[model samples]
Target: MDEEKKGTVHYKGAEGGWGSVRGITETWMREVDRPGALRTLERQNKPGGFMCVSCAWTKPAHPHAFEFCENGAKATLWDLTSRRCTPQVLGRHRVSELKTWRDHDLEQLGRLTHPMRYDAATDSYVACSWQEAFEGIGRELRAIDPGSAVFYTSGRASLETAYLFQLFARLYGHNNLPDSSNMCHETTSVALKKLIGVPVGTSVLSDFHHCDAIFFFGQNTGTNSPRMLHPLKEAVERGVKIVTFNPIRERGLEVFRDPQSPAEMLHLKKPTLISHQYLQVRAGGDIAAITGLIKHILAAEEKLWAEEQRHVLDVDFLEQHTEGFEALKAHVAGVGWDAIEAESGLSRADLEAAAQVYVEAKNTIVMYGMGLTQQVHGFENLAMIVNLLLLKGNIGREGTGCSPVRGHSNVQGQRTVGISEKPELVPLDTLAELFGFDPPRDKGLNTVEACEKILSGEVKAFIGLGGNFVRAVPEREKMEAAWTRLRLTVQIATKLNRSHLINGQVAYLLPCLSRTEVDEQASGPQTVTMEDSLSCIHGSVAHNKPASEHLLSEPAIVAGIAKATLPPNPKVQWDEWVADYGRVRDLIEQTYPDEFAQFNERLFTPGGFYRGNAARDRVWKTESGKAEFTVPDHLSAAGFEDAPGRYRLMTLRSNDQFNTTIYGYSDRLRGIEGTRDVLLMHPDEIAAAGLKEGQVVGLKTDAGDGIHREVGGLTVTPFLLPRGCVASYYPEMNALVPLSHHDQESKTPAAKAVPVRIVT
Candidate 1:
């Protein structure tokens, strides 16, 4: 194919099959030889092998030999790459020059192979010993109040690593444990905690086998978690319906051809049907859509009872286990069909058809992603989903519950192991009693809160476990400008990223082992554990060689800091716990006895062990002591809906990208590639706005704060979409989203729905 044809080729094939094989082959050859790549792939998701460093999809009890997907292959092989960013490379480039590079190019510069410190005198980084780096970090942290320091972590780290990081922060002083979960699923955590008394999904991967239908909201199953396609295809073949509620028509949900299936692969058979119905919900319209579904079911239930003397609503289950039925019924009945149709951009008949599917299924699941969580009314949005499920009393059933499609692998695991801004979420009292020291009780900053503190001169130090924070958040212009105001910044990472270039007065880059690399410690080769989205914990041990000889395990890095920063407590042993990660798990067990009791032992089970949700038994820890229905006063916006020319912008990732890391320029499935500068809009809307296809336009966001927020030179493309809605790639378009544009309750950046206008 020609260069233009390569980027613009429309993928008419299914999600997997030949397309997936081509992708895997391309990435494997680019990163490593086929033999080496196969060697690594053979162990991925196995009983004691390394976990895929991609999405938080659960592992089946009897996993397929080829459990990894294209995304997984890219992530794993990227770590096993031969490229290395040695001291010589760092010495050759200036920070200013490196800051101007593309995100993909920056990470492609390869892995960091040494402990490096930023030298402001030369505007470059120089090699330093781990001891010098740790001591300098300790001295700087001690000079400032512990509360002034934000300890951030990415989801890539292990449970032991996150545990030590949190323990180190608490021993030093505060509970400012901000993580990737705060950016993506904080709405799920906070909302589910209030409604169901659990901050995680109650359904397991096995639930797909028994469920009659699955409802997906805002999450794309194909690109985000390709391995999840197996169960989805199986369910579809077994007569289960898949109903999708998303603003875009995702290729993965429509059709998938499993590459592992020899019959289909050899015969070149047709793709398996994935979604029975795909509804394009308008941006920020999840609440309206869900409300419509509930109303249709309620009306149907009344009709069934009044005419045929039959009942469909689970009145017995509701009366026995729930608390706020009358209020929910009255509030939903008060909502009009006209309002629902206008807000959701769907006709009443369409919604009624979708609702009838849910009403007929004996057991159903509601699976949602950031689409519902990253909005102004995200907290209220989640509760509404639970209300729909509760109308039929789906809770505590075999194949019925809520599922939050957590983006990063083990992001939820980090939160379960005490990485949170809220001090009360973790067992501080037990932590204190076990660790023999008084832990800090004050609430620390979350992602947005931490950024605000940094810009306001309150937070002066940042110690991130493993994320591209500054580049991944909103108000890119302001955050990048305010980044240098800090005194100290420490980032533990496997590769170079944009966040490292925006350095502090005293900055250090600590290189750590990736999940695919063996981590040798005092106790020899150690394995780390992670919790999947279904609350199951699995062990991961690396087989690939380290990217650099100088790299250290995350546990060792955390221990080094703990030893340098704190006066040794009588109960906590930093070195010993890290020497044997089993000690860390034991400590976890003692701290949270109910969920993690005998954690080490249970992790040895064939498919690992369940973290155990209280809601599985209909146990509600909410204030009312039962599952409660929440009714928001009104559907709200993030302060920009009333303004003219304000189009709802949903920022997303291309197929070849993850969070903020770009692997390639082309998103083959979308048919627009080779560059991340195109904006997609409806053809009618473009003509109505006096714009044409291929016109270079800019987007401007004015929150009325008088700050100039604009991104220029985006080539407009026509696509099938809801009116008044446009889509763009994330991190590239993150500049248009201001720091103030976030969910009101959870404070998650509403990247799914930023209000902006197209400019010439």
Candidate 2:
């Protein structure tokens, strides 16, 4: 906590109005000149412009003139910042000295202008030629057993880059392709695939317009995906009911004022009220909350059955399109209202009210975010939501379906193009036939597994396409130590991050062009494609010049390393593929012909093309060939009943940040300012813990895994969080979350529901 900085201020208004304008303007001015900012802004998300490097929220069919959001503007300007990290900059600072700087400070050091290699003798990074850097990485990767090498990717990667990176990893004889999705939406993929036969949301952005009722569970759209507010605002104006479920009363879901609209921004129009009904569920209580709603609906349907009246459950859809309804109905009926009320932090009346809204709506959409997925029973939470939807036949119908609002621009695209650690999911036979090499069949390591492997010395080499893996993953100290154990670590990035600071015995930083920079190759300026949260594949072309002449496109960087590592195969032309990304798409189409047919042709279409979801078409691809209802044996709240003064802590992103990238010290929407070192708690809980507002405290996990896990110097603040539930900024509080504490089925870290004790 900086004494000179101002204390937190409670903002009393809606999000995304004048405040967003100010934020975007301030970020743009601080990073780039007016001309550069204007140039970037004009082309953002437009035809021949770059895709937003932030959330995966899909673009509208008809995008606005200013299509970007406040956070999007920050991301663009941050990438196109004039500040450069040249050789002189590296020469001025040692690795040890750089490690002392904060994460945001390190990022502000600006973009890496050239490739650099760690020199032990000099104790600093020395500028290296592209050829030498690639060959050195190639030699090191080849020296290790391919199975011992882990290739990781961030969601920021383009489809072409992801395809090439995965292809390179496979050709080298391994499938250890872990990605950021493993940490974020892997639970959604796993649960949705198991229940609905697809690993993505069934509904598109257009569904928001026609849906009679929208249920938002544990998502903060205002900060995470601000652009989503537009449709939400429209839905509100159209008199559609919007219901929200979360521990915190997020201002974004409550109300929003469109900054892009002149009447709202210039004339100071009234903010659009968002959620018609808001239910505050306890942390890790999403399963219980959803189950409670289902329980209420089931009870209502049973009453109607006893009376021989009209039923709420879509009996026709259930009989024709689904299975196991009786089992689900029985399970819900057995769960008492007392347990549901205690676990979900909602009364029977409240749950019944929500259930009534669901029953009355002709069509409904359930949208969720990381809040629902980053918990111990995350998979179960998703399953319950799907069960509710299935009861109403919400699958594959217009204005009705499940939507998981994803983070990152191309996370879905990366997974769609085969960036998976699971070898069984990869089209091994198709890949072998297309590339003329036998693909590895062994299941590889996911993010958590890769970290453990590195710690145990099972993995010797680590390559990251993008993302600050150190700060992004749990068990931060352990992960940093694991990196040092790696024989070689390689990062392909646009800017400096903490991951680069945490180095291996042999470390390399390969500078790559940002999404906003033109990726000119031997053929011509290449356009890369991205899949939004809704699975819409759209082309993104960069009109701006490269940030640095030395910087290479991610595809080119991957190609260079692949060429250096593998022997020439006449069947695969790495150089040609790098020169023209269309060739990469051709291969992807061939690999998943039915799904990606006409991939190149569709890239040119306005607003791009949809990769048809079978579930969306009511075409169930499950073993039974029908949508199956899953029944949870038990739903447990994540808190200690015996441990006194214990709080259920959830890690959240501030409005000033996106993922791990800290844009500023202020979270204006939450009224937090000047510091990220604070905990949000209910006033009653603060009194119960004998803590005063603004008092510094320490948080320690009760995991007691022999490893000491604690984060100190956190200021406590009273907010509207549920009792026994507390919130803190992520990455800062990531240390409190144990690596072993994860969702059982998906292996995704349970970052949202860590039980901890507060220390005065």
Question: How far is 115's C-alpha from truth in model 1 (Å)?
Answer: 0.5
Model 1's TM-score against the true structure = 0.97
Candidate 1: C-alpha RMSD after superposition:
2.6
Candidate 1: regions farther than 4 A off: 1-10, 636-639, 642-644
Q: Assess the local accuracy of residue 177 in candidate 2 as a C-alpha lDDT between 0 and 100.
A: 90
- Tell me the tens digit of each residue's lDDT in model 2 across 1-760: 1121133335676788889888988887888864867877877877567789998888765789889888998999899888888878977999889989888998888888999998878789999999999899989987889999999999999999999899999999988998998898899999999888999999987788789999999898989999888888898899889889988877789878887778877756788889888888988777777888888787778788889888888999999999898998888778888888888888888878988899888899999998888877788889888999999899888999999999999999999989998887878888898878889989888998988888798999989999999888889888888788789999999889889988889999999999888889888999998999988888898878887899999999999999999998999899899888999999999988887899988885667688889999998888888898998755753523425667789898988899889988989988887999998887777788888988999998887577888899999987777777888999888898888888778888888889888977
Residue-level lDDT tens digits of model 1 in 598-655: 8877775666688788887899988889898878655543335645577899898888
TM-score to true structure, per model: 0.97, 0.97
As a whole number from 0 to 100, the lDDT of residue 464 in candidate 2 is 91
lDDT (0 to 1) per candidate: 0.86, 0.86
TM-score of 2: 0.97
Candidate 1 global CA lDDT score: 0.86
Clashing pairs in 1: none
